[model samples]
Target: MTTTAEHVDSGKAARKRVPRSGHARWLPPVDRPDPVAVLERQGRDRLPELLPIRYGRMTASPFAFLRGAAAVMAADLAGQPHTGLTVQLCGDAHLLNFGVYASPERSLLFDLNDFDETFRGPFEWDVKRLAASVAVAARENGHPAHRAHRAVRETVAGYRTAIRRLARLGELTVWYERVDAAGLLPLVRPARQPRHLGSSLTRARRRTSLQALGKLTEVVDGRRRIIHDPPLLEPAGAGDAASLRKIFSDYRSTLPEERRLLLDRYRFADAARKVVGVGSVGTRCFLVLLTGRGAGDPLFLQIKEARKAILEDHLPSGPYLHPGHRVVAGQRLLQAAGDIFLGWMTGPQGRAFYGRQLRDVKGVADVAGMNPNRLLAYGRLCGTALARAHARSGDRIAIAAYLGTADTFDRAVADFALCYADQTDADHAALGAAVVAGVVPAAPGV
Candidate 1:
């Protein structure tokens, strides 16, 4: 095994391969692929009718566009030189993707919540994406460019500081590190902290399977059925419903024997095809409603189709053969605590799908409502959470060595973020133009 000193030396050596300051460059290559074309290619296999909703949501703002354009950014990052410090990346590590969710123990924890695009790659890719997102979000909230730069800097600094701290701990200690949701408030300036944060926490606590039962189901013909919200949420057809029931066993088998027993307590009630997320709108997604003991007992499980990671083509081969398994494994490895019901299985037509609870005290910060100070604090918090996650899967000792005690990497990333935010604005305009020319169909306001 490589000694600790060797690992630290290896990390410092990576700077020679890709200098820390080299990250600031962001000029697009002359032959760079068209962003619209990339989106069109992704939509090729998705539901044709729902593709419009994806485009419509993306056109709402540059930040929205960035959220939906992970593939585009993946390609861009692939073209750049990196530190070669590999980590299981939350490939789409934008601001909104990091949030608070409940562990199996029911304690709320702040961590990376989305994993549809998770894959292994250079650690800097995730950091760059996070920084770029901070810039885009700051611009969207009408913050000045200088303030955006400061926020991005703070983000990278947070990651650097956290990585160094974790490097000093034992293996099990580093592996068990987690960010408690209740501890988040201390990171923000007391005078600038918004009043809504407390209410947001309360709201997240209220967002349980029981709450979903009230909002998404009704008694129809003496049976509790998922309500239809058309184009967004629609009842599954007879064939779809039968297919779901048939596949439930396959998914159940993927779970641990103990978890299977817990799941057995609930009886399958109804299901619906639900549209979800900016990038995932057209993907095959379903919500299965299960009941336990009585009508008051409810459990909601989301089964989402899993495609290849957006960064797959850009990076080397990963361990998992199945896309769904890739997502589940990456989540388990990166998260401090994981969902008990998390599992993956193949569905109809041999498509990969992963299942987990639909709601478990989940909440995301309202980026739109945040002022510059609050956004800065939130960005730093996200940075710290992200570092904790990366430390779990990557070489924390080497990463800390690469970061050193200087702010060089932080400022370079902030510069790149500002430049890339401009690129995102241009790409957002390109998508808008395509919508206007009818080159792509867009169901605005959907």
Candidate 2:
């Protein structure tokens, strides 16, 4: 909560500390950490059997590599000069990380969905990561270099515009602002697309607990239980009634009294390991099923292990020793609307874990094969969302002023994104080379 800038002319002060022209600048001669070694260290805590899948997914493309290399980027970001303005960072603020999910009112809302790597860091760090992602994704889709740069510029412009607009409003107004599909459907909906948002929304809506149960579970003797698929959706050994009761109680204790009462209405039924995102493939992720009254009513909660965030060791440690609590706290602070089951608990072996709805209109957007113009539009949406998140958690007035009204910062960011994207490609290639040389184990085409 300390200001690194003078009270007056704060914008000028920030520019002086980290010149706008130097935003694209990176590193100062000394060699960087071995990215392969970093990956090896990260693998130590993950499920051993799933590490091959993680490597295979990461080896898919440069963009996938970036998603899995949060640790490497954190090391780099830590070495850079910062404005000392901190926010509750999503930590991995890539473009694909944002999505549409159902809010408390059942309204579809767009915001940052992944929070496993959430932590406190420089606000611009998140912005830079987002810009890099836009560039990387555009390149993956075979867009021209100029088009990628243009998209990055548009993203920065969107962030600037959103921050300036929010700065003019009251704190409460900024806090309440959200991106809703219903509000945007009329403007963004395309022709001949029968449903709003065309296919994406429809896919998300169909990802209900009942639908998941139908696909992933069946009658096991007298009771219905989850079907197991080795390495992806397997049982986490046999469950102990007392241990399960204790963990459930601990998770419930993290929620508000009202939320706890609401959860109490349902009885626990079954649970299974649920392999999720590319970066999180090796993590211990599981889905719990709860039933209420008739068999028709089913609720699924995803319980995911929370390790020390990628930013934890790089930045000064805070009061949160429990990573699950850190993730829950960061998610609540950044996202306007959060899950009703957003809570944390310490699991067996003292592993931190957080639980949320397995899927409630939870949809992830894909940027691959999108045209330059559409990619630019997607970039704008993500940038605006990032700015809103930072404004909620950081000194909004100072940040808005620092960015100013000129296009200088936007151009600088675009340049930085292009340059760092080149760096990411090199790093990604090194990872692939390492795998080929047997320095890193990998299973390709998974």
Residues 96-126, candidate 2, lDDT per residue (tens digit)? 8998888989988888998999988888889
Compose the digit string of candidate 1's lDDT tens values, residues 126-197. 999999999999999999999999999999999999999999999999888999988777675457455656
| TM agreement with the true structure for every prediction | 0.99, 0.94
Error of 2 at 54 (Å): 0.6
lDDT of each: 0.94, 0.83
Which runs of model 2 end up more than 4 angstroms from their true locations? Answer: 1-8, 27-29, 185-197, 239-242
Each candidate structure's count of clashing pairs: 0, 0
Name the 10 consecutive residues with the lowest summed lDDT in model 1.
188-197
Predicted structure with the largest lDDT when compared to the true one: 1
Structure candidate 1, residue pairs in collision: none
